[model samples]
Structure formats: structure tokens, C-alpha cells
Target: MACSLCIGTVLPILRRMRRLAVLLLLVLPHGASRGLEREAFEVYHQRRRAVSEAHPDGLILLLGYERQEAQAVRSPFRQENNFYYLTGWNEPGAALLLIPAQGDGSVYQELLFLPPDDPSHEKWHGPRAAPDDADIRSQTGFESVLPISKLATRLSRAAKKRSHVYTLFPHRAGEGKQPEPDRREKLQTHAGELPIADIRAQLEAMRAVKSEGEIRLIRKAVDASIAAHIEAWQEIEAGLYEYQILGPMLAAMINGGCLRPAYAPIIGSGPNSTALHYTAGRRRLEPGEVVVMDVGGEYAHYAADLTRTVPVDGVFTERQREIYDLVLYVQRKVIAAVKPGETLRGLTHKAKRYFDEAGRDAAGEAMGASFLHGVGHSVGLGVHDPIDFSQPLKAGMVITIEPGLYLPEEDLGVRIEDMVLVTENGAQLLSKGLPKEADEIEKLMRGR
Candidate 1:
């Protein structure tokens, strides 16, 4: 079907779906009755148990990284979603350890060493959630919470026994890069001086699998994200400035139920959309202009990442409709390819060919290179998470289906994203409340 016909037919149904979805969520039983503390502790225990069973004499380390000091818009020192999922602690300077059960009789093998609240620091930094006896017991399922200063001596002892040590240490981005320096050096020094077996692979292997608790938290994040996109769509205007829309878009996510933004919101209007990773949302939108807003929300600390491109005028021009439908086609097809035993790398390769057919390479570039980024990343505690590339897409894994076409010279970029959870049968769309069709978006904006 022609693009115009497709939009005319599909838009109304999508709008109705959005309305019904929103309604259902309002009446739905919110799973939030279970406090966050207990949920987080449960998730950590599941991961630790799996890892411990595999390597009984191992020491597992979970580290939370802080934002670099110099950057103005640094992400707050959020723990690695994986670390937070397992530790149930959110603080700038914190660490968690899972010492093995030990000869089947170690009384306090599961230990959490956190920064206890100091009165003076609490006064300056606001009240920190001090780990209470109940918190230490219920939240982590750990035996005790000690001052972080004890880690050194504990590690020294673990090392003397030549125990296995697995750490979720940092890694560099792009190709052929090594792990971050501070961590790389720390791991190297510990293994060399401590006589411990480097079992980082063991932790990596365990993290690849998702627990039922992780899946639940991820679903909540997706639920919050649906409202965020709609809020951005509804508040946007033909004559509004870019950042203005950006603010309300995020506010909607928080109001809808997200605790933190999954990642920096991408709010680009008009020609600014041509730039990938456009951070400065400063354009003044006018009629006939397109706004490419890619934003997400984190709920229970799990991430829901999504992207949607729409016309600010609430109606797509012929060219806009054509491009939008093409992008959607590529996105849907690639998502359909997601199933058990599919390699993400291979999935991207397959999606690229469709992207090319969708006119993404109107100018012609390397095959699978037109879109120029990974098909999508796993979305969980972090916006972009690690997946088990070595294994298949297990039933519990959640991922994003985002495919886009960027033409800097043409002043166009369109990406449609949705969060999906891998299921035994196929994939489940978690961000089901969000509308996608142009006509649907227009009708909803008109309050129809």
C-alpha cells in the first residue's frame, strides 16, 4: 500500500489502542505494593545463588560507578543496574560481596559492606537511608552490613585461600578497547598479589541470565515509558521550542511512575534530528517540522528505552509519511526476528538489509552500516544492558527494538522504538500503551 493509504488506515486503530492501553493501566493492579527494598534484595539473592552454585569458592564483587567530576550533565552515580538489582543499595560509594557458603558451613557468606550514615555527612548531603537491622536482614538476605573499610582485610583473607574472584568491572566502549583503567589495574593487582583465581567470566556468565524479579521491574519501566512518550506528544506544539517539550516529556515519565530516566532524553526537532545522539534540545519548532524525541524512564531502577519520530503539526506530509512508514517496517521486521537462539549481531545484520530496502541507504553506505548502530541493547536495571550473546535469547531477557534512518544532509531522522520481553512463545511488547501511527498521534493530540 502507498504511504498515504497506510497512514490513513493504520493511524486510527493505533490511537484507539493507545487509549485502551492507558485506561487498562489506570485500573490495573499496580505491583508497587511490594516495597522496593525487598524486591531488590530478592533479585540479588537469585543472581548470587546461581553464581555461587557454579563456583562455590568464589568471591563476587559488585561495584557502582560515579559520574566523572568534570562533566556538567553527568548521570548521577547510579549503581550498575545489575549491581543495584543484587545489592538493594543505592549510594555513591558502595560495594557488595557474595562470599561463597564455604565448605557448606560458612555462617555469614553473603556480606554487604556499605557506607554507614554518618551524622555530619548526612547533615550536609541530606538524609541517607541508613542500613537498619531489618534492612540488612530482609533486603539483602545477607547476614550483616559492615563499614566499607573492612573490604580490604576481607579480600586479603579471601586471596590467601586462592579463592575465585569475579567482578562486574567496567569496560571501554567501541571496538578493541580494554576494561577501564582503575578497575583493570585493581583486578590485576588483586589477582597477582592475592593468589586468587580470576573468575570474572563466572560473574559475566551469571549476569547473562535474567531472574523473574528482573523481568517484573523491567516491565514497570516499560509501563512508565509509554506515558512519557504520549506526554511528549501531547504537549508538543507547532510553534513550541524544543527544550520546552523535553521538560514536560520527562515530567510525564516521572509522574507516570518512573524513578529515574533510563538515559539522557533525546529531544531534537527540525534539522537537529539529523544529528545522531543530538543532546542539545534547543530548536524552535515550526509547522511541517519533524521532532525526533527518543526518551525513556526507569522504574524500580530497570530501564525502558524508546524512540519515536513525529511531525509537530500532528499530521505527516507525504514525504514524512513515507519515511515514517519505512522506518516502522524495518523496526517491526527486525523485532519479528527476535526469538530464542538468535545472536544480536546476526539480528542487526538481517535488520540492516531491510533498513537498506527501506531507503535508509538512499545515498549508499556500507551494508548493515546505514543505520550505524547496534540493532538495540538489552534494557533492564540500566538503559543499555548486557545480553548473553554466547547463548540464546532466554525467556526472561528484555530488549529494545529501535531502528532508525539518519540523513544529516536531508535534515531527517526517524526511529521507532519499543521495549520487548523475550517469551517462551515469542516476544512481548511492554511499551504497549504508546501510539505509533501518524494519524493515531494526530487524533490523540486533538483529544479525540
Candidate 2:
């Protein structure tokens, strides 16, 4: 009788426990529970290995962005570019540690530190992956995963043996509030004497050259941006407000599977075109004026940048065609010169020379004077991916060739931009799908 009563009581308790477990699983963030989207595991693994090999004498530490309370209502969260480049982890409050092989024959080590899941916060913001998750290591492609709370302990322990710690140091003036600074503070607190070296330069060099996988993602971004431009051509008309054109382009990008634009879509019409970074889309496009639509899309963290200048009406005026042709000529000339061993600064100088020799604008000033900004910039995770301007171009480097002449006096601005992939022999036009020729753009706008 006593054994039967004990069994009956334990049965109800076990059932209640099972019910609670099921409820907890259901409330866990979907992305955390099932693993968020990421590239192939090997891709990140190789990247981490490269960084480790670069700094074998020190410990490499990288911290991701912290969770923002306002982001829930204000904007979506984006992982830090460098951290994302190495680990491909999109979650906030994550850090990566890589230990190089010691001369004593100790093997290299890699660890991913993740924040513990907050069930209460998850109720409001959705499920988040915790370090304790059964599949956390597999999900993150890390051999070892630990709670973020243990980061200080690990750093302290590693610092005892290492002479230096390699991490991103803030070089920009206004970057004090970023993750790098926070990580630096932690290092100071935990490992007082260990020197902290900047790992940004190495990362920048690595990022300047596009890997095959990165190129593929960039191609996707370019294709989506091209499609967006095509949608704009179909929808744009003289009577429409500038903002109206932005909607269709953005819609097309989203439809093409892009998360967002690489940058703010610059929908500059008429005089607004003279402003290089103009984004005000409130103006009504006029029949005789030209509009410069500088837009691109971001896909899977990669970015594409493209610019097209077209007449608000179906055809460009005589003056418009003259300036447009000149810009196109310069852009093509620069792009043709894109090959290994050619430097970006050298290319810009070449483009400027073309603009100067092309002719004078309506104001009698040299056309080159109106060509503001560099001919192009590297494009990758960031639209203007960081690179040394003087560094020689290499195969697999993706850059933009944008040549423009903005004349505020004539309310005329022409910028012809295209994404180019540096090839083993020459250059490949990634934005070839989008028509940039004045005649071709006119035909598309005319619904031909």
C-alpha cells in the first residue's frame, strides 16, 4: 500500500515537470532554438584559422554588438562587420577568442562566448540562443561555446601565459562607444599588463580581397540592385514625385531577397542631383530635368552600389546627352584600366584626366572641377569596404567605377556607376544587367 501511494504521487510530479519543459521549449526564440541563418561552417572555420595563423604569438579577441533595447521598435539589429566577417554569427552579445599554437606543442584553440538566454526578455523580443543550448556549438560552428559571463575569466587565464592580446582598437574619432572600446576596457580590467594590439589592419587587408564565396554573395546583391533599378525605370515618369520612384526600387530589392539597401537610396532630381549624397525624395521630377538614382541593395551582409542618371521624361535634352556621354566615356575608360597591379588612386587620376580633357561645362569651368569624389571604392560587407587607396588592385577585388560631373548651375548632374569585379586578366562588369547607356535608358523608360 505504501509503495503504491509513493508511485501515485511521483507520477503527477513527473507529468507536471514534463509540461513545464515543453512550455519552455516553445517560448525559446525560434532562431536560437533552430540556429540562425549563416554560411557553410567551413567558410567561417577557414576565416578563423586565417586570423589565428596571422597572430600566432597572441590571443585574438573579437566582440559582437550588445543587444539594444530600443532596436526592437526603432530598427533591426546588425552584427558588427568585423565580427560577422570572422564568425558569421548574427547574434548580439557574443565574443570570439582564438588562441594560437604555443611553441610547447599546445594546439590552437577557438571559442565562441554567447549570452545566456533571458526568458523574460524572450517573451517580449522572441527567443534567443543561450550558451547552454544543446546545439550551440554546432549552430555557431565553434568547437567550444561558453557563457559570456566567463569571458573575463578566460581572458585573465589566457593573459597569464601570453605577452599580448590582439583585438580591434578604436581608430576613428567617434568610435568610443563601440564594442572595441568595451572589449578594451575588459582587457584592462582582467589583464592589466598584457599589451593590446590593433587587429584592424590585418582584418582590413583580408577583407580587401574578396573570396569566392563573398563574390557570390556580392553578385546576388548586384543582381537585386539591378532589378530594383529596372523596376524604377518602369515606374518613373515626369509627373511622379521623387519618393514614388524610391518605393518601387525598394520593393524590387526586398522581392529579390535582399534585407535592405546597401545605403540610403539617393533619388536626386534636377538641382538636387548636384548634391552628391542627396536623399531628399520630396521633389516632383520635371520633364526637362535629369534625375540621378544612386541606389543598391544588401544581401546576406554583402552590398552592391550602382548609379544611373536618366531624363525625367523619356528622352534626354541635347545638353543632358552631351554631359551624360562624357561621364559614361570616363567611367568606361577607368573600368577598362581595372586590372591586377593597378592602384585605385592611379585609376582616379586617370579618370580625372579624361574629364579635364573631355571639355568645359556650360559655366566655362573645366569639367574635371565638377567631378567630385573618387572614381570608386571597394564594395563588400560595407558598401565602401575599407582598403588602402594606394594598394594595388588584385584579382577577386570588387570595386565601383563611378564617374560623375555635377553642375548645380545648369541643374545638370550625370553619374554613371557600375560594380566591377577584378579579374585575372581584366575586369568583369557585375552590373551589366542594368542598362546605363543614355539611349538604352530612354528606351526602357518609354516602355519599349
lDDT of 2 at 83: 90
Q: Which parts of model 1 have CA positions greater than 4 angstroms off?
A: 1-40, 63-77, 102-108, 129-135, 175-192, 196-200, 358-370, 388-391
Residues 8-44, candidate 1: write the lDDT tens digits. Answer: 8567546645654564454334423321323655566
Please list all clashing residue pairs in model 1, or write none if there are none: 44-86
Model 2 spans with C-alpha error above 4 angstroms: 1-37, 69-73, 171-183
What global local distance difference test value does model 2 have? 0.82
- Give the 10-residue window scoring lowest on summed lDDT in candidate 2: 27-36
- lDDT per residue (tens digit) for residues 1-448 in model 2: 9999989767754654554445344434431222223578898888889999988778988888776621424556678788999999887888898988888878888989998989898997789888889988777888799999998888777765787788887646431123234467765665568888889999989899988888988988898789888877776666678887887676667666576777878999999998898887899888899889999988888898999998888799998999999999999899999999999899999998999998886678888999888898899988988877799999999999999998888898899899999999999999999998888998898992
Model 1 RMSD in Å is 8.0
Prediction 2 TM-score vs. true: 0.88
